[model samples]
Target: MEYLPLFIDLKNRPVLVVGGGIVAARKIKILQRVGAMITIIAPTLCTELKKVLFKQNISWIEKKFQPIMLDKVILVIVTTNNAKLNALIYQNAEKRHILINTVDDKNKCSCIFPAIIDRDPILIGISSCGTAPILVRILREKFESLLPKSLGFLSKLAGIWRSRVRQHIVDVVLRRRFWEKIFYNGHIATLIEQGRPEEANKVFKYTLNNDVGNNNKKGNVTLVGAGPGDIGLLTIRGLQVMQQADVILYDYLVNSEILDLARKDANKICVGKRVGDHSMSQKELNQFIVRLAQKGNKVVRLKGGDSFVFGRGGEELEIISKAGISFQVVPGITAGIGVTAYAGIPLTHRKYAHSVVFMTGHNANGDNQVNWAALSDYQRTLIIYMGKINALNIRNNLIIHGRSINTPVAVISRGTYQNQKILIGTLIDLEKLTRIADYPSLLVIGDVVSLHSQMHWFGQKALNYCPTYLIAHSM
Candidate 1:
């Protein structure tokens, strides 16, 4: 990391700028917006700078660089054309432990300017550690484009609820979850999109009461699929449950962005299972879900991918059924199809495989007890879940059972989300593939795995182009 990016609160603080040219004028404008008391020191002043000084009542000293100018200043900007003078100022500021920025001279400065995206209460700072200023600017532009223009309005709306939520929701966990849900469930996004300040206010106010009632009613559990890591992949029903939930019990594989969809007044509990880490047993988790629902709070059991597809969702459903609590299930895009689709690999194709098989690598006793001989003879696509740990063993068993070593295999880690990885190999290379791959990966084997290149389309534009083809193929 070349530079640590941070936003310094400059309200009512004194700042010094040592330049009177365009650079100084630009810095002054930004500082003035944040209500910084700016003092400009230079022998000459630009027309814009002079106008700002007169209009904004800013202090201006039409003089050369002086070391004494640094006293009583919170931040200093050396924007003069003289590199030597800027370097001198940086050295002096360093000695005094003062924050200083030398324009375009990162090496000679104590601090560097960051590409900033401001939406009033929502400020995003981006930096490339002083290595790639252009890259940082490009990233800032991309985000700025994606962010709504009315984000400032939405932020102000959220700010209005801060104190009210804190006061009304006594539980810290519930309060945090409530705010997260409000922000994540597209409430704020919708408000910004429609530019509905008044409507947004009303909606926010109504949500507070609704959330409270939802929290106090006869609690029910909804087993929700978090989708394949991407927030956009979540179903409409899944999002609805998240918005109304009083408490969310989430798994390890569930994305944080999905959890952010829950109401700010809800409680968030992590029940994810991690290898080598002590976690609540399946029985304990089931009981916990039942207990939460019995407390008259709407509970959401959020899991990764599809809840029923190797997510131990059946176990949870059984517990909820026996308890006789009101319950529902919101299916998500299962990993087998979701991951392969995103990776451009079709699980079933007319020319490749007519059928697809989804199987678990391990059973209830955590043993690789799959019928290898039968599976070897199956001329179809195979999507294996929880197979990373025993991938080598499965591969060898399949080979011994008459499966060819050349069968294509694709191991996808963290599928359908950013940071997703796709490793393609064959049965013979399974061990090497396992070593290079990370956890939470799925394995796909068969001739269908070779079609990923033509079928892949997980990014923004892929959905528009591929869904038509997929639907037509299915028909």
Candidate 2:
């Protein structure tokens, strides 16, 4: 609350800059975009500013700072290195009520530069009151990734349609709801993204006329991958879907904290599945999704890792498709890849493993569908999901099929999380090593497991783990 945040229109207004250095050049470019009439008062201009003085309609007074220069300007920017001269300009500008911003001097600044994310009309400003500039920069970078580049096009299109929409929909609430659907549908945005503006307009008009405003609209289902255990692993699209979800059906592997990303009023249901334990049967879950979508509620089927990778995402998608429900799949970082990296066990290495295969150990009685003979190839790093219970069988069968028992292995549980547990050993002690891990664990088997000793990296555990004992520990 030290400084009030405001966006001032500098269009056609004269703004004075006291320095011609790189910092001044940077600010001048921003002002140029906003159609500001810039005038610089510097004894000598930098090479960049000299180029700008010639190319742009800029006025430069090759003279020292003086009080008379502040008369015509509405705002003053002091990037001058001379402290006494900067203070003189600030005092004079303040007397005339002219907004002044002194570079790197908060006390003399009437305004400060904020980290701005400009998606045209979608402008977001982040500031730390000039206290933590680096933190502000980092936050801005993160926001830059989180926000879509096509947002400007989307906003412009929305602006163009505003009058037409207002004229058609008289009611304020209904109009707001219509805009929400228009934005959330992403059809127009996708068309714009794919460079089909004419088709986008046609669809936009069609959507406006035929579909929206009422609760009778077909609900959407976005299958989001909650990668491994770390919430950061979730994709930007997945986070957006979660925020828009009217109902979220999540699994046991999904971090509970991820559920908080959903809309405040969103209905969250735990349909998590565990081995030999049923929260809601898969059939029941599929039916439930269809039932919810039939009632026009945006449903988000949140699963851990990549939903397509042994997460039974394909099964759910098939059911949704057959039901004629619109669905989107936001692919996640599956545990096989995400967990191995977090545990510093490479799925493929140049010297150890040339290929990697991911599989599931969970199966019903009499299900011998596994191709263990092919999986026994040590050259292909094998990543097994839910293989904790069947560790003994996997270890013995692989060895029985001529695989070396001395092959290195690592069992990672709740990978990418703070309390994640990882035990390392060889195939000889696979079962014993797995016994230390809980559910939602992965088995990484190959010579690449030996690389864990070299590249032991992650958050706390990896950073603090003793590399000396990486000689393969068992239970």
Candidate 3:
């Protein structure tokens, strides 16, 4: 610990700044936000500083620095270009016992500006002891993405309830436990973020009576969709539940990168199921989740894409409900919609196909349950999920049932991911197009596939895909 980290309240306090350039203006802005009464002593003020002169807390003097200006000043900031002058001011402030900060000079700084994430009433400060400023900046960027923007609002709401909570609970240990329970309940945060303050107040009041220091410990479960291999696409509500979860059960397709965002102490269990690989039966997994929740653990069943879309989420919900467990679902962007957008293939186009159908090609009985005749219409787009192994059957059925052999087709594997691959061909070449691609591929049939070349936008090599009939379409 090279420097002791402390957050001092500077509201309505006198502070002096010894320069008026852009850097100095930045320092002034931070001070202003903290309600500091600031005076800048310099020959001229920068354009930014000039714009804020009318502010009640800011004052400027168009004069050079002098020792007498340190009188009654609680702190001083030196941002001048001249090293000698900045050092002179630091020495003068030091002799008078006034704390000083010199911009870009760690030795002269009695205080250094830390990287701040201001969720007002809740501020997170990060510092590298002024040794690794860039590293600290990178850390700030990472946190900026992980933290919800509604955090400040949540903090403000908590502050509003503090007095009431303290009055009702009375005991210090009980009050602390009560607040911890509130933080663990994702529903309360969801209500506050959704602009439902009245509903949120009701929940808070309910928790105060039923949950505060109560021995009746019954935890809940949340079904969260991880989306299509993109951590940025995870919902705010999903992130909140993940952070609060004591145990997380994830699938094979759920992005590992997204799981890294969860609490470090969380227990992660791999209940992933593939086509022929069964980690655990669906019934067994459901019982496991219920058992964990019954023991008062916050359990999150994290799946890939929309859990309702062939993710067997409905089945799990049924099982959990039968077990008398509380559960909620946080929907995610399903592959039928998300992957098509990334591959630049619209599921429905007015000039091409108006109606879009999403169907599963991998039926458990290995039978063609979908109506090939109805889907053969040229006016509709067909999006088949997990259709790679059954590509030959799908092609034969579509062509045998009035579809054109020359109809455009596309197979997108690992859509919206860094290693995603797209293959283009006609219906006659459907099997060939899917042969070289990876599993979890999406099969798109109809004239909409022609738009892939025109709308290709997701990855760097999107336009560089191998195609059997590139000459039939315009690139």
Candidate 4:
């Protein structure tokens, strides 16, 4: 952090600017946005500065830079072209321990103005610690592209909820978690991203319900799909369930982006099951879910991809059923299909595959099982979930069992997210492709994989690719 970023409420606050040139004009424009009472001291002003002075009711000193001009100022800016004058302003302000910026001269200034991205209450101040102004501008531009225009409305929504959260959630730890979950969870972020202020406000109010845990109501459980790895891929219902959850039991493959949606007040207990490590045993997890629900708290079983697919949702559902807890299932974009589609490979095509078969790579029964010979003979697209670790074995098994070695294969890592990677190969080279790709990936096998060369269009912007009609006609 080059400069400590702080938001000073300048409503009726006094601020001083030492020049009336373009630099001073720029600073004044920003201060005006925050409703600051601005005083600019200079003999003359640029047309832009004069226009702002007339429009904003800013006082003009119409004189040289004097040390006495710093009196009663809460913040100061020295934007004159003269280096000596800037240094003098910096020195004088330092004596009074006042915060001041000296235009582009970082050495002379007590503070440096950051390349600011403002959605009013949702202000993002970016600085390269004063090393690179151009870099900071570039970063600001990138953020501008990613963040939506309705962020200002979302910030206002947060401002309205802040007092309610503080009044209700007394525990500091729980409160912090609640705010973290709001930002990390996709619901609020997605609302802002899509510019839906009204819906966002509704979500905000729902999460901070005043009568949240008053009665011993039979808690409801929502089996939510966290959606591949992308937070944005989570559906509106999935985000809502996360926001109202009292406890979130999430798996290892669930992306951090999806976890960010839960209420900051919610308890997040990771039950992510790895190859050899289990955070919580199935029985303990079952008991924990029942106990939390009995306490009248909404519980969310957040799983990566579609909870019903290979996510062991049936086991959790059975436990909930026996416990007589109310539960609902929210489907997610399954990674095997989602990754392949976003990578531009359709699982089923009339020209190639007529059907798509989704299967798990690991057998929970702990046996060398799957009937490979039968699967190999099936005339359909095969999508293997949790199979990155055994890609080579799966490929060889299918080949030895009668599947063609020339069958196209695509390994997708971190599917549907910004950092997603895709590797296209053949069943014969699936092992080599696995070596180059990371885990939490999917394997797509069949003729559909050949479409990726033409269809790979997930992260690319519309302008980067030819129109779909044009591409199809060209093909």
Candidate 5:
């Protein structure tokens, strides 16, 4: 982020090089690839620039570094062996507010050349702000091998059919989904590499024609879990469905980075619900998703955590089935498992707890639904979701039902995220833990909670100023 990456059009643009040595020749060769009108300002020419002088559209000025050479030029390059002369030209370009690159000098450089992986129209630039040029070159070579040479053919084909796609698929979202489905799945690329562009065009036309919500088209709905606030926890199938979705209905708990993986032009609507802040009622949302799928639009219901575990996915799918809509469920890493693992708390350790229970703190009827008798077992680890608000109730009920007040407990908030925080205490301090914890937090109550001292790994990266507190709390 230190330098903003840019790809400028240098075709036929006027540019000046203030030296005629090998380094200057290197810059000139790169400029030549972009077809820049080059003017070399130096008293003598090296073997490289002398050979370059034979090329057309290249002008040589047999003179020392002069201030007038930078006038009316789009860019400037200072590659002279004389350090003072290069600095002088750099200062002149800076005064004129023109982009300039002083070779091997980061401070004097207004721009720096990047290691490029060129696949014709598909150009990938790798740079490290001149700090690690060798590392960037290695990365460029890796990308050059990973990306196929036929990539440019696919991009160019998309360009040629862009107007035709727009004409056929009236909806912008549908058109983008059409392209994402083809390119991301590598079907069009394979056809082009096989030298069957006519077949590729036919595939494009067929995809576009079928995207108009016709009655013959039966749309699909995918219930995908986005995982607990981390893009890495998302299932491969979940990411695929998101990329192919024409429309996505995501929850508030879903990570913004996970949502960014969807097709660029896909319609993303927030159906997210907070504790008391409901954007859309679940009843209305269930019906709305079904309606979208019935209309031949591929819809994705993106929920946070596992779709089946307290995510109300079954209720939504039941409604989808009643409406006779085709649906698929892509499971995701539930917070009960993923968040606990990140916090270094194992749900069931044979020496500490032989059994584990997954429960919700808040339900439709408030607090009466929980079976405290079954939950008070000594050898069981309890994982409670949406339990921050009822932490006091849970503490009192478990103690009243024969669970020990001295049992270890932990409250983890925003788990698996960079801002994740963990608070460790005993069941007696559960109310205090709730006061310090945020909403959408998880509660781990059992002897297994004490094992966090030995197993703790992830700490809040933003808490670098309080290292002592972090270590003391984890211990």
Candidate 6:
């Protein structure tokens, strides 16, 4: 983030070096490989630099550094031992907006060089922005050993065949798939490594010809849980499926950071449902998913929390299954579980609660209304999802069913996120306290809510508000 890495074309470009020591000689030799027109400004050259100068064509000033020398230079490398001179050069270069590197001084440099792995047309540059340089060198050495010397030859051959391959395969995705098959099929690269160009060309052409006719490809449909608004809570499998997805249909509950993990070229569609806002109906979504998979797109349906827990994942999967589309599901942490743990209220404790129940507040007065009379036990914990809007209905129903009006309750907002908030109060204050709690909040009721005071461990990152002064004023 501190510095953007760029590969610039310095071929036949003017460059200035401000020292003639061995350190400067090392950098000059690297510049020479890139075909830069290097000019050296020093009183005299060391033995190493003198030998290097004889092997390459370079301009030698044979005098002290001056400000006028920077006029024609595209880049400046100050390898001189004098800190003041390096600083002076950097300041002047900054005014002109020219790139400059001050040998061991990252603070003075506008740009720094990276450790490179050169394979002709393929070049890899690794840098720590001039910090921990030894680590960069270790990485470069490791890559050098792992990469075959024949890679450059393979890349050149692929370049030669690229135009022909594109002409055969019209679609971009199919063309990319074709190249992937070629690289991994153990034919083209292998034949070239064996020094048989004719065999490689024939094999490559035959594979392309056969592939052009097989256009009816099938793609997968994956249901990934975005977790409880926490990127870290997302499973590793969830990340992988997202990266490979060709089209992703995500909900509003998903974390924005999690969506950023998908490939840049992947099509992203928002099919999220808020408290009262629905982007697409459940029936429409199912049909759309089926259509996308039938077209051979890797469609990922990303939902928040566990897909089975109030996420309507099973309903969507039923449609896909009936259509004979290949599908998978990646489970995530549900809000009821993830939020309570973060709020320091356990759903079940041997000493406090024996069992826990999960339900949605959306059905408080609906045709599918829950039986609250059986949930009046003081020892059992009740966690409600989609409960923020119906906090009054939920509280009155529970109280009327013999649950204590004074039962401890906590309304949590943005669970498991960095800015999560927990509002503690009794069942009598549930409606009032929840007024300040943000949307997509969870309501926890039982003796376990009392543990919030003793077990609050989210530290300074979370805000805790009890039904003390704020509720009385807000209500």
> Which one is best on TM-score?
2
Query: Model 5 compared with the native: what TM-score?
Result: 0.55
Error of 3 at 330 (Å): 4.6
Clashes of each: 10, 0, 0, 8, 0, 0
By TM-score, the better pick of 1 and 6 is: 6
Candidate order by TM-score, highest to lowest?
2, 3, 6, 5, 4, 1
lDDT by residue for model 3 over 1-475, one digit each (tens)? 7778888889999999999999999999899999999999988888999999889899999988889999999999999989999989999999999989998999998888899988787788999988999999999977776676677877888888888898889999887766666543545765665567787788788878777777545667889998977777888778877987889999999999989989999999999988789899987998899999888777899999988998999999998898877677889988888888888998888899989988887851235577778989988999888888788888988888899887888888898997788887888888888888787788899898888777988884443344556655645
**Residue 8 in model 5: shift from native, Å?**
37
Give me the displacement of residue 391 in model 2, in angstroms. Answer: 2.3
Better of 1 and 2 by TM-score: 2
Per-residue lDDT for 312-418 in model 4, tens only? 88998899889877677879988876777778989888888888888987751224578776668536788888786777678778888888877777777877877
Over 4 Å off, model 1: 1-216, 363-368, 459-475
Clashing residue pairs in candidate 5 (N, C-alpha, C atoms within 3 angstroms): none
lDDT of 5: 0.81
Candidate 5: list runs displaced more than 4 Å. Answer: 1-216, 363-368, 460-475
Give each model a TM-score.
Answer: 0.52, 0.84, 0.77, 0.52, 0.55, 0.57
* Residue-level error in angstroms, candidate 3, position 261: 4.6
Q: Quantify all predictions' global Cα lDDT against the true fold.
A: 0.77, 0.82, 0.84, 0.76, 0.81, 0.82
lDDT of 1 by residue, 114-230 (tens): 778998888988877678888998899767755656768767877777889788888888877676555433354444444567766776777776765253434577899988788
In model 4, the clashing pairs are 177-264, 178-264, 178-265, 184-260, 184-261, 185-260, 185-261, 344-455
In Å, residue 278's CA in model 5 sits off its true spot by: 0.9
